[model samples]
Target chain A: MRYEVDWSILARPELAALLIDGVRYTMIVAAVSTGVSLVLGTALAIARVSGSGWLRWPAELWVNLARHIPGVFWVLFFYFAFPELLPATWGSALNGWTSFALAAGIVALSVDNATYVSDIVRTGALAIPRGEWEAARCCGLSPWQQWTCCLIPVTLRTVTPPLANRTIHNFKNSSLCMVIAVPELTWATQQIESLTFRGIEATLVATLFYVTVALALGVWARRLERGGYRHWRGAGAVWRRERGELARVDSRR
Target chain B: MVELISVTKRFGERTVLADVSLAVQSGEVAIVCGPSGSGKSTLLRTLNRLETIDAGDIRIDGQSLYRSGLDLRELRAKVGLVFQQCHLFSHLSALANVTMPLVKVKRLGRGEARAQALALFRQFGLERRADAFPDELSGGERQRVAIVRSLALRPKVMLLDEPTSALDWCLRAEVVANVRALASRGIAQLIVTHDLDFACAAGDRFFLLQEGRLREVDNYTLACCAPEALRGLSSVPRGRLQAVAA
Candidate 1:
């Protein structure tokens, strides 16, 4: 197979515009969805651990349903099914909106990723020792304050590896937006392939982009783990030095 | 002052604490001792409403914990708890951990809270370790940091649940000594332990809990002389008593 690839497509002004637009749309969808998923997921996690039957049942059902359902189904549902369920005027406005693709992508990704985020946070929250809760209560922290201060920080640190992995997963899942004609990276590549008959090269370039970003995120996560470990080591050294000094002072006394 | 009145706790069919009643006056050090599974921990936990009671009520400074509409956060601020596991926040520096309650719960400014927390760390001889994380500290050091974090709020009562249980034999003495120093500062303390020596040394008064009920013992002399009296009332098996003694 003698493939004469036209590398000029990369430098074309029209292609450059599409690539820029694709990256912008992709980032906007991912960032908005990440924020929405984190807040909703954290709330779901708290409800699941609340030990109340009402809160637990609904939270579990939401997580299970979201996790089991295919991500593509959510994209289609938000883009199609949801509009029909709304009031006629509102439905038409949403359906006819220019930002419909962006809105649909955000909604689908938020719902799909929120389930995994909530599960990650819940595991971290539950792993905390019962004694920490006692200590928080003893300090007279309001339930809300305790949740925000003591519980959230520890849970976030403990679950960061998984949570960061999920964020990267959501980033890749943005490629799925091409199905709804959102014109992200995959969609841009397809456009190039159809116009220039250079599908393989375009796809290979896109794949490299995804791989590079994902690998960089993985490295950052590893650094965070090492930083936490180093912090623990520093504390131990200081403690020993203090004890030694105390002993010296006592001997002089 | 804290009081537990006819409190009972059950996990499904298993009864952890059964119809227990006790009173802790202001500035008193009450040490609770028993074999494992004797419900000593459950009693201490109930004082701050950490473990909810299935029956009866727990009153802290005249506020009923079991009653609806009580502010649990304000109530918790008045009562401080230290755990045997030294559950310090792994992500936070020691100073940040100590200052957390002061800033978040008490709404103190960061500088003000840090100053207070640093003073607490100094008091516990942990000033140098304030910038260190929990995992970096030794067992004894971690427990001291945990105590400082709990006491930073200036709680009226401190609950020490096996504070030295997680430490090695060598480390246990140092942690117990810090706890004894806290007692001398006139902080009301309730210590739950299986270590007879630690209980005798740290507790101003001892209480033997068996089968969810507590009987006060004036001192270690009485506890040792009438071991049978405690054993007779306790639901714990004889084998566990020998294990505890060993």
Candidate 2:
């Protein structure tokens, strides 16, 4: 059976607007979930390596439980099961909320993505040399200061590649929201295809967006690993100021 | 400025430091020489409370280290430690490595921290390499930067663990000179190393650690053990020892 390709259906103003809105929602879900997960995952990783049984065990359990469950399950659970589990009034309110599905997708993706991020960050934290900690301590930094100024920076730097990979995965996983009718890119594509019989074109556009974003994420990760963002202009200013100070000191000597 | 009072530390069934007592006065440089596993490193770590003692007490500038009210971070800052591997924050530039504690711990402004760190770099002849990362610096430069980072806090006492482990003979001499310069600035030093040449050249007092016990030793004993010490060997044959001594 030969089928004719018709790109004209997508030319309709309403259809184009729907697709644009879908992209916007998809980006919102992906960006918000990635940011929340990164911060939460870093905290979880710290708790896991904090050496206290109380903190470590709970974090371990959470990460393990999240990892064991499928991403789709989390999406459905947050959208369908989670509201049902709440109190009667709250459940009804949440179910009736217009943006409930969007909230569920963001929450579900963050929860799922955070576990993988925690594992990556934990490995990076553990891999840091003992000397780095001792160095921070010797300079009089408190435990919290050490992690913030020394340990965390180094660990995040080391885990950038893996963290980027997980972020890209989470971005792609936003498509899972279609199951709950969250109106993300994939859901919009499905809608457009059913209405206009242009599933191939819509799917192609969605796929291109995902591939482009993922590839861009890869580039960003590589740049970060190379320390490309460090500005030498600040260092140069410091250098010039110090040189003047040194000249004055040398004259005194 | 630093005192260890009969400090003892043990790991499982093994005793690393046993009743080790040592005192280092301000402006003095003390050397601790020992073979591998002789508790030298553990003894140094105990001063900074990197490794807690099972018994005994440590005092820095007349304040008890393990007392209930003592601030561990303040004590660590007051007692600077230089690691064998230099351990400069691999992600930070040499200047940032020195300025971090100044800005974060000492509460100095960013510009103030930069000036202070740069002054140390200039003093240590490392001003040119301030923007370089740890991996970009040479072995001696990294060690110097590590020393500078510790010195930036104006520590009362400095603990160096095998500072010469990665340096060649020329760099070892540079370290000896740097130690003397530091002493002149009234900062006491306690160094743990097997390099007799470095110890004899840099040390004002000498101690030996063996079998978990620490005792003051003279330069002659260190000279006598030079052959075995240089090799880091536990034992040297009598005939070879005599030949080397002769």
- Taken over the whole model, the C-alpha lDDT of each candidate is 0.78, 0.87
- Write one digit per residue (lDDT tens) for candidate 2, span B1-246: 899998889999999988889999999999998888888888888888889999999988888888798888788888999998988987677888888889888999987898888778888889778777788899999999999989999899999999998899899899999999999999999999877778889999998888888889888776575664434534334565687678
* Model 2 per-residue lDDT at B71: 84
Against the hidden true structure, what lDDT does model 2 obtain?
Answer: 0.87
Best candidate, DockQ-wise? 2
lDDT (10s digit) by residue, model 2, range A40-100: 9999999999979999999999999889999999999999999889999999999999999
True-contact fraction in model 1 equals 0.69
Tens-place lDDT digits, model 1, residues B49-101:
77787998888777788788987777777788887787787756777777767
**Off by more than 4 A, model 2:** A227-253, B225-244
**Pairs with backbone N, CA or C atoms under 3 Å apart (clashes), candidate 2:** none
Candidate achieving the largest lDDT: 2
Off by over 4 Å in 1: A229-253, B10-19, B166-185, B220-223, B227-246
